[model samples]
Target chain A: MENREELKQLIARIKGGNTDQFGVIIERYQKLVAHVVFKMVTTEADREDVCQEVFVKVYQKLDSFRFQSKLSTWIATIAYNTSLNYLEKKRVPLLDDVAPQESPLERIAAEDNTPDETAEYKDLSALLIEEIDRLPVQYGTILALYHLEDMSYKEISQITRIPDGTVKSHIFRARKLLKDRLLAKYKQEDLCR
Target chain B: MSIKHLSDKRIQEYLDNKLRPESLSPDERKHLDSCQLCQGTMADYSHLYSGLAQEERQLLSPHFTARTMAIIRALEKPATAISRSSLFIAFVAVVTICGVVNYFINIKDILYAVEAFSLERLLSGSAFVSTMEQWSSRLGGNLNILVFAGLLLILVGLIDKLLVRQKANRAYFMSV
Candidate 1:
């Protein structure tokens, strides 16, 4: 059966008082939830705590889940809102500096052959993520949903509760801004070198 | 087809494949193909897209799954316990309702028996009537005491309910 169907079955069982079935559901979507949460929160610690809270809320409100969207989408929405709540509680500034840790591309560069592999696509990935991080929260969110998460506009609309037209507009603006920022970064890097 | 100005936003839409090729007028396509700036912009975006695709595959920390599972287990325990407790509370409520209904129905017969004994004494003689009169006056005094006691109990219950409601409101605000 499809993964969604399998998840629905597990959810049904969990709601029917079979708590053990929840373990399977958790195992299946854990990474997906963690990734989404990590994208929203600043620190690893906050991400961990919020991820736990999201699941707690999920279990507590499992009976109320209407299955209007896929389980993953619902979980992502929860993760997004939970991280936002965490930010609100901490009074952290929005659209702040990107996390100071090495970008994922940089981490990947550190793991393998350096000079030869670097020729493939030098600083593009890091530049793209930086530009995306600089975008407004709504724009950044839509870009993440579209490019990173591979969700359709309809799915993004459902998760974000935005109109499809707005989703399209945000994505359009996000990509334009990313393109400008990347080009500017490339020019600056060239000038620096 | 004449060359028309293409907005930067439209260039982005074209790069992301959000704009259908058929939707672009012939002049727009011609400009896209011939304009060096737009072409260069498209190449840069394409390269960025390809690089992002590769980076997207990097899995999160190895322990991510384990940590998430631990959380889910912890959360599920409390949730299951809560559901079970709510079910138990519902069961208790149903039993209490049944017990109350049963007592009201069964207790009526005992009440009638007591009334029958009182009526029999009244029908016997004048002495019984005088005794009943005294007893009734004593009962009237006791009933006054009981009515005052009942009002006091109701007042206490109302105060308790008000205090509980105040506490609940405070707790709710604090949680928010």
Candidate 2:
């Protein structure tokens, strides 16, 4: 997290035609941008393109930044919007709810080659990642920003343009969804271990 | 008083440390401390929280920053080459030249001169079209200069186009 004075100095230098300084900003925030882009975009090539596009846009639009929010929040907001636009262009669904055809865990189980394969793998973290990927785009994005990036609901709301209360609700629902999916797939003892 | 098991929300909140110790009721705390089921649920959520924090971030290629900087550098070169001030100056020069030309040969006068030949007379072939004849004779002398200026403008436009396309190509190559 960059303080206001540090961010101002960095941005001032970049706007003063020292574009190399912008690389520093990119290095610092690429992980933040990647978190949002990776969750929203599934393809590797497209993800790389969108990530590059996000930084390019940030540099181009840096002059208009009013510093109303943390630079990270602003950068995350750009990443989120750029990813959404890419998805829109690709005609991918940005539906908020999980598809009703099957429960998320059940869907994951069905995809496995063997019913006991997940248990045999014994890597709950990897299993959770798979489950998260199966969620709706919005849920996956919220989870990544909230947990991986350690963003607060308010910061996420600002980034996603969701209401603060709705952001909290989404986080709660997304977590419960993950927990339910994991619990349904494995015994309590197996998961607790 | 009998205390039911902890709800999932309560367990989650507890795991998140959102429920402070003082906030927990005596019965709830006692039950949570003693109950195996609630404890197991807490362990599962704790596992989830830590896993998320420790999840590996997907990284861009190692050359990502260098590639992006190259694109920015390419973009900036064209931008510095053709500045807003230069474009504004060119625009002002065109407008000034047009204004000066308009002052000397008023388009309104030309239109008025054309209207002088009434349609009725022209249809009847009785009119000599003196007004149009006078304007054409006047325009004929300046036609060479006008053509020269028009060609000059076209050449400038083509040069601008080529420069822009070249800049675009350079940037595209850098991005690759």
lDDT (tens digit, per residue) of candidate 1 on B1-176 = 34566786666667567557975667888988788876776677777666555545343556654565555554434545445555665565556545543544345533543554575655764365555455446454443554464566556556655665565444322212
Model 1 lDDT tens row, A1-193: 1276767787889888787676676666666666666666756556666766777677878887887777778877887778778778877654453342654335444545444443433457665665665555556666767776677899888877789998888777666666655665554444334
Candidate 2 chain A: 10-residue stretch with minimal lDDT? A184-193
TM-score of chain A, cand. 1: 0.73
Q: Each model's RMSD to truth, in Å?
A: 10.3, 7.4
DockQ of each: 0.25, 0.48
For model 1, state the Cα shift of residue B88 in Å. Answer: 17
Question: With candidate 2 superimposed using the best TM-score fit, by how many Å does residue A77's alpha carbon deviate from the native?
Answer: 1.1
Q: Over the stretch B40-129, how does candidate 2's per-residue lDDT look in tens digits?
A: 888888888887777784478888888888887887766655674358548955885586558556787557555657686577765346
Where is the poorest 10-residue window by lDDT in model 1 chain A? A113-122
* DockQ of prediction 2: 0.48
- The C-alpha stretches of model 1 lying farther than 4 A from their native spots are A1-4, A16-20, A92-122, B1-3, B18-20, B57-60, B76-176
TM-score of chain A of each: 0.73, 0.88
Alpha carbon deviation, residue A61, candidate 1 (Å): 2.3
